[model samples]
Target: MAQVLEFKLPDLGEGLTEAEIVRWLVAVGDVVAVDQPVVEVETAKAMVEVPCPYGGVVTARYGEEGTELPVGAPLLTVAVGGTGGPGPAPAVEQGAGAAAEPTGTAASAESAVSSEYSGNVLVGYGTAGPAARRRRVRQTAPAATPAPVAAPAPAPAPTRQGPVPVISPLVRKLARDGGLDLRRVRGSGPEGLILRADVELALATARDHREPAPAPVAPAPSVAPAGERVPLRGVRGAVADKLSRSRTEIPDATCWVDADATELMAARAAMNAAGGPKISLLALLARICVHALARFPELNSTVDTAAREIVRLPDVHLGFAAQTPRGLVVPVVKDAGRRTAESLTEEFGRLTEAARQSALTPADLTGGTFTLNNYGVFGVDGSTPIINHPEAAMLGVGRIIPKPWVHRGELAARQVVQLSLTFDHRVCDGGTAGGFLRYVADCVEQPAVLLRTV
Candidate 1:
């Protein structure tokens, strides 16, 4: 008897209802093993590779690359038992084909089929077969008196091996760019073959001793030739869609406030002096925003343009608008509500590094309840920022400037920073938005407010 199995899209993360199919690694009739990568998906934040949970021959593909699929929708089908006919029909038809009957009853079928095979399995899709139910039994027959077995000679000691081999072209290029010796890297790819990830790991390990490369010289500007055109795809296309949707659908309002952050900067400098990573002013500001959002959960929300509903999140996930060479990329930190300031600083460092290298996955880019964009690094004072939709608000931090202020009736120079909050007016009114900004400004002006809340 032949058995068929359907593989549905697994839940990627919180509040993620759907994803775009970026690529498929297998085709019909291709044999696949459990835990082998079968497809790559692009979620709102990053691209992720999903593995097959069953070992079988692929029977059908449910959707094409670039098609958006909802969670729990069948992605592919596989035929087990070697002789099994094509598996269940895909939920979405790509072409004309005879429809297969819906397999056994949902409750009993999954239970009966899943109770069979015993192996390390992926979540949701359990193993199937008689081996899953078999138990080891002890041998009870008396052993015959053994004939004299030949004495085995002592095994030779293994020789010490050098670094693993490099085989990937991408890894080789990365190693060359980083001025690394491929021979010195222990590869992590299949059969010890070096990959781009391994080369990156090697570079990270030797970062302390490696000298930073000089910045690249900019190309000289020239007059446009007769006709020049460039097709927009991939990141460019995604960015244009997101920007247009945010601009048209979300009714945004902006407010600016100034803070004397002399204390916060001093505190950060003191912490760095004690051998900690250099925490930036923007990072401190992010921490404050997260703290304020926790107090006013309404601020950390998204307006559903299609549903005409405001969805408020229980936890805070801070998204940072990182300017990348390709374009603007917003990668979010998951559960900012649960992390400490120090941990947030480390996450910021990791996120920025991943963004710059274009290494962020889709999961890292989605599910943001709030966002922060720092123009301070570029020496900009302040400007109105467009809210990153789904997320009701985005806070912008501007450069710190020395300004005269009255301290106990005496004129004194203080480091002042401009902060702008852009919020979705559809969900938040002026009063709510203003209060949120005022709370954040208070926290920045007096770092002790954070301690009091804790």
Candidate 2:
């Protein structure tokens, strides 16, 4: 009378329809306790750990790593009674609008109930089974008599799950280019699987190993005039889609201003020299944006195009555009308004590093109320960056250049940088946009404005 229970995939938030399995914490034959982490899942917005709803021995794994499973799919099967002993069958409870069928053994009824409740695995919900039983130890034989018995050797350690598999063609090509062995890597994909990063890591690890150099071979003839061709997919594809949607959906207005950031640059240098990682002008600018959003909450808002309304967020979450080999990604710093300058700088470093390594989760990319793109890093003067929808505004920082300016009626060369602000004209007027840019420029020029505002 062993009781079997099926654990289905849980629904992650934000209306996620599917998830890729990043890893499985337990395997068949392993006994797991209720509320123990059983798997890691990657939804469109974040990577989250899922706990077992019921405690028991895992009997079967339903989904393989790297498989993109829709919500409500079965993930694993667990058997609930002690090993080698039959347990009482499970009871089935019928809900409203259902007809009763012929009664059967509790086991059969339990199976039917599990199948019926297969869909709708929401987070924090319990699994479809009876409560877990407490563990018990077997009694040992009496010590009294006989010949001493030799102890058996311990069993070998079980193999860990391998890299998640990559199903996308673009991901596969990238993995191949990195010379990765997919079988050895575990995916952080929808199902317990391998993804592109797993392959990249494998290649990186392989490169670290030293070996005798291979003999030189003649170069093969060119198949076609050799020119680099990068596929517009994954991050690149996402960027294209986001930008296009922002342009088409948001009524954008661009405003430009010149900021004299001499004091701000000095403060940044001092902060970096005082036991902090090197802080860039871009970072200081981001800090100013955070402060500005606090003073003017409306700037930190989004437009619900479908709902035909403007939604103003209560807190500021800043998104910084980071360029990776895959494409442009905007990893966000949540609750930017609550962070100190030093903490913000640290977070910026962490997010940038994670993005470069392709290890950022969905949570790092969403919930941004405003965005900043540093075109200055590329030596550009200034250009309007498209808003990251449904956010209503974005800021672009340009290169600092020595330009002629009048100081006390005398002309002199001074360091100046151009700032571009793009806002949703539907929600923000040109006057509001200009005021916001001016406030930012004033802060950059003085640097003390931030101290006052903070």
Model number with the top lDDT: 1
Per-model TM-score versus the true fold: 0.53, 0.55
Q: Per the 3 Å backbone cut-off, how many clashing residue pairs does candidate 2 have?
A: 25
| Candidate 1: regions farther than 4 A off | 1-227, 275-278
State residue 402's C-alpha deviation in candidate 2, in Å.
7.2
Cα lDDT tens digits, model 1, 1-454, are 4355766566655444556776666666566776666676765544556666667666666667876655544566666565443343223233222123225543243343333212222232212212421331222222212112122223321332775465334456778898887766654332344445456666765773456786798887887786777534455557777878899988888998988878877888887888856776667787788888877777898877688788888888899888887678888888887877678888988888877755576557777889898878889999898877667888999988899977568989988989999988888789988999999888878888998777
lDDT per residue (tens digit) for residues 1-454 in model 2: 4466666665454555566776666665566676666766655553455676666666555456655555544566566655443232233222110112212453354344334324333343222111221222222222112111122213322335544444445456767777654555544433434444445555555665545676899988978878897544334545777889888888898999987766677778888788846776666787899887776667788878689888888988899988876567899998887877767778999888777655566567877889999888889999988999889899999998888877569987777899999998887788888888899999988898877866
Cα misplacement distance, residue 321 of candidate 2 (Å): 3.3
Clashing pairs in 1: 45-362, 45-365, 45-366, 46-361, 46-362, 47-362, 116-129, 117-128, 117-129
lDDT of 2 at 244: 92
Query: Measured by TM-score, how close is model 2 to the native structure?
Result: 0.55
lDDT of 1 at 382: 95
List RMSD in Å for every model shown. Answer: 20.9, 15.8
What lDDT is obtained when candidate 2 is compared to the true structure? 0.66
